[model samples]
Target: MLQKNVLDYLDSSAARFPHKLAFADEARSFTFGQLRACARGLGTALADLGPQHNRPVAVLVNHTAANLAAFFGVLEAGHFYVPLDLQMPLPRLRGILETLSPAALVYPAGEETLAQALADLCPVLCAEEGFAHPPQDALLDARRGRVLDIDPVYAIFTSGSTGTPKGIVIAHRSVIDFTEWMADACQFTHQDVMGNQAPFYFDLSVKDIYLTLKCGATTHIIPKKDFLFPTLLMDFLEEKKVTALVWATSAFHLVANSGVLEKKVPSHLRTVILGGEALQAKQLNRWRAALPAVQYTNLYGPTEVTVDCTWYPIQREFADGERIPIGRACANKEVFLLDEHLQPVPPGQPGELCVRGIGLAKGYFGQWDKTRSAFIQDPRNPNYPDLIYRTGDLAVMDEAGLFTFLTRQDGQIKHMGYRIELGEIETVLNSIPSMEEVACLFDPERDRIHCIYTGSQESKDIAKLARASLPRYMVPNLYHKVAVMPHNPNGKIDRPKLKEEWIHGNDHRL
Candidate 1:
């Protein structure tokens, strides 16, 4: 049967694993049955508070088992959810609130002061209080009956080019399709225990949340503090008996480069899937050397396409200097490349990555112009309205049908009257044995390229090697060495923050 609602996955799993732990954190845990009951009670409270359907409900809470229940409760109330980062600055959070104007704001217990500050914007509800409300089965059943496959399930905010957050609304069908395909492709089963690294607000967490419900598996929300200490993080993984890991590439690099794996390894981890950034071969080689029997897969996509549209299972060994192919499209997704004119690019040529399938998002919330600009009609389909999402990322395909990510479209900069890909320069710098992490940013106003890296080598020595490897114009004109590289909440290198600090700071030039 076709599943029109994501709650169906949870309902079936709860029936099968009523007594089993579905989600856990350091302080609390929730069984499948308990989670369902909490969600139903909260849904009833929300439905009675605001007799509206198909509106946004912003959730501000810590990353815990309760967060998952709140998300399901919003869906149960016939409304989509919007997760707000607790660590976000007040100004930015206010901007998002201004844009969302949600039907209600749901806050965790002990955050009444924070909730009251925004009461003027909309109604506010305490999570614990809502969960204690009596369940209204008839009202919830009627609300659920009105939901369709195309209804929006959740909305995630991503950084926009204009500095305002662009909320990406994903529908039930998109997530349902992606989760079903991922479960089968990755062979997820009830016995698999997953360790999730992404935050609730990030789209990467979607895979961990829904995949567990679809497969009747358990997921452990690893504490954020554990990531700062590599050995402690390994201990947490070992103690939890985690069998699968769905993590960002930067997090994988953190553990591999720490040399802790050489001291101790998580014996039970069988599957490691990485995404949100390109996975370098150097750090991956370290992981392979230790856990040789574990399965490693590379996933690539933007939030606009569920979690990921492509998957590459490692079948061969890679040299430290070689690039890992992003590989082919996943089931039910149509992934291709287009040139400047929207025409198909020939094999071996780099072009913009485009995707069209059941996984494409509904579009940006309340921003129709931006949505129309990105999700547009396929030029090839002149007779019909076939839509495709144009991802600004660039890639190349080999004759054997393997796709290799090159860089972002904006990463291509005109320096010294020559078009240069900053990623190519960073690749050369990363191959240096003394270099640990590296990124290249261009200053359009000054027409200069700056290299920010963390490693043991001196700036001049690294520059000498870069000069020998890249063209004269592509070599970075400025270099900044640091003891530690800055990263964002999603675990990717905070490129924007780096640009603000390194390029726009007082001492920008070498």
Candidate 2:
């Protein structure tokens, strides 16, 4: 049986499968024993810097074997790890640094420029040098002894509407609970080989990393470029003998839409779990037609409630236009809907989806007000100490208790398994000197982002600036420059009219 914390999972797995391959990237792989040794070495190095337990350790590195070791190393040092995207613009990265004020920053060699800039905030430790030191068993053991299951394990920053990124703090218990339920629910085993598709900073990768480690399974870190080339991705999956894939819906669509799956199908794949956006039956049909034996599931959840709170296994076929149901809540988790007045809505009535369970996060780091507002005391439960997360997602429940996703009740959109706030795009665009006004629209049917803006600068130039500040998924693909933005009677930008005009006129430049 898995223990109550992630560290226990690590210790037990390393003891059981000391020589078995645990994690890998494009460059190399690590055995369970080697992973533990490297993490212990880094932990001892970190402990030498002094005791800073309960503080955050910023890890700025690409998705590689070293990065994986550094994550466990942070925990081994009695601190939580915060993974930051190395591609983020310095201005935006600095903003996160201000909010985090991390105890130390860990990065691979050759990032000295970034290390120096943030050195004023905290010490910068090079992972290359840290891992070179001999393992100090006594120091690592002492640091690990201070750790607790309820303590924060990681804090992932997601796009926020307030022109800043919000860090979602998750504890060790939440990961343990979610991973335990996921293993049994998905039927994961030590013999399975898992392919990782999500980035380390994204919440989806949490399942890929922890579940693989806990189950003593091998994890192949698929490269970013391979996803763009479906044929190559399929070949790599076959080469690695990846039997399970927990990827975003867009990834599967890319293969089906690009006609790559027609050329090659991943023969070893047994389980396909898709999330981050609603799955179209058309796309699902393409995969089902090719691989009849594989099990397909649709997962749904926000970062605030861990990776996924609900799941739907695809057993029956659906028409092209039909959307897949998000299914029922996972074991040990509860999902219900509430109207605008915070009262329970009857079946078939649209309501805001709320989730309550052991999978819930610890709330936004350093933003008490924001955390309290979104994660409030459950009004429906007066007898027990209960808290539920208002998911900001509008959904309706059928007679069978399956949830059909309606529309987002907020400015957020899930693209490529990342929850993005459209306001974050406008915030970065509005920062441009020549930008007069900006609005971002999402056509869910097409899974595309349309940007309508009135600005003196060239549209391409605006996009260039956006690319620097925002992740690729959040950057608008279709750009439109208009003489003036449409406004309603209230003098507010008429987003509906703008969307309608774009659809009718076909004025998008790209």
Candidate 3:
């Protein structure tokens, strides 16, 4: 059962606006015609793959126009792509690939030269030359090809505490739903220009790719170094007249306080979307002060459900010291709170939040058992057969049917034999006036918890802030200040680095 591929959206967009710019960075800009032709060529080249070789293809490429082409090309070829971070250590990457034994190894033109220097690999396609051996032009032009009903769009690799990293497999339907929802929710027209912030590997790029391809909008790709100069980044947005953008919560905070970008605001920017973490009310206030008319959205979801499952639009004024809730589900998705028995929980009682609908992914790439466990039959829905993914997140709904995220069930800590939610500790940390970003990690070896931070505060001020609402044991034993918290490409906290750098072999106390 072949389904419509993600690139079909781009193909349709190209037909309507062949000359409109589809992708751009400081180095180059691609019109819809050029981008579509490149994707078609890559697809045609990859279509020559034999039946015995049909398996997931893994791609390790940097954030570039080439990666963007591969993103669509892999889907059009009827194979899922495993996106690996370009900056990851070679050993870590080797471990990931050894697990999947992917069919094709896709990389940039010059990367295979470096790859050969490290390990002998197979079936490698130079991205620049991917379209070199194009298919018969007439057949390629005439054949729309059969797109499988359940063919995956892409496979995103995520870390696990044990074993190799896992791949979250998203299907074409989920990608299409997200794009259509975005087109409506954001009110994007062909006039809108979107900026690509997150790397092609991370889910944030989904918003960048689909919005442009499906909605007939223009897109601009941002480089990594520009982020260091938050003010200059804003200037770029202004000069380009970007209408909308999405960013990680950590990034939004950095830009708001970046000092260089203080009210050096862009005039045409409208929607400022954020995700991968909870939004602090005080941070929202700062953003509102700077761009009052801009719509700020808190997008929430794991990689299993495409880019996001739910979103909260911050519309009005809020209290300074509060944390905004995760809010309701987006269109085409339904979120419900379930109790210990997996039955629906009444409003206001905390329960595990579950998701069901069009945004759900096909499954994890190779771990069928794990995928089966997460995807379950929906007990509540009666409109034909339905399956829901247990989100493993604790949440509750208010009288208004608006759901709010509490914390991950895994985030619970049995401290001194008392179960404590990390969200509670993080909220206390946010209450501190000077604290910007806070992450509390438990150190069992030292029998203490370490609170890591980056923001405006002295040690004494932070200590004073900690003692105000927390019991003595709840306070972090060690306080370390750094320039910023380690964040993955998705803009979420990198707790692995936190453990490695600050927690390992440390026996110090405050």
Best by TM-score: 1
Arrange candidates by lDDT, descending: 1, 2, 3
lDDT of each: 0.90, 0.83, 0.76
Candidate 3 lands at a TM-score of 0.92
The TM-score of predicted model 2 comes to: 0.82
**RMSD for each model, in Å, please?**
1.3, 10.2, 2.8
lDDT of residue 262 for candidate 2: 75
User: Per-residue lDDT tens digits of candidate 1, residues 1-510?
Assistant: 878999999999999999999999998898889889999988988999767798899999589889999998999899999999867887787788889989888888888988888888888998888888899999999999899989999999988545578999999999999999999999999999999899999899999999999889999999988888889989999999999999999899888878898999899999999999988888898999999999999999999999899999998999776788999999999889999999999899999999999899999999999999999998779998889999999999999888999899999899999988888777778878777899999998889999999889999998899888888999999899988999877778889888888778775243
In model 3, the Cα lDDT at residue 469 comes to 75
Better by TM-score, candidate 3 or 1: 1
Q: Which model, 1 or 2, shows the larger TM-score?
A: 1
In candidate 1, residue 191 scores what lDDT? Answer: 97
Model 3 segments more than 4 A misplaced: 1-3, 51-54, 117-120, 135-144, 161-163, 379-385, 416-418, 444-447, 470-474, 501-504
From the highest TM-score down, the ranking of the candidates is 1, 3, 2
- Residue lDDT tens for model 2, 334-407: 99999999999999988899999988999999999999999988999789789999998888899999997765
**How far in Å is the alpha carbon of 368 misplaced in model 3?**
2.1
Off by over 4 Å in 2: 161-163, 411-510
Q: What is the lDDT of candidate 1?
A: 0.90
Error of 3 at 31 (Å): 0.8
Question: Residue 348 lDDT in model 1?
Answer: 98
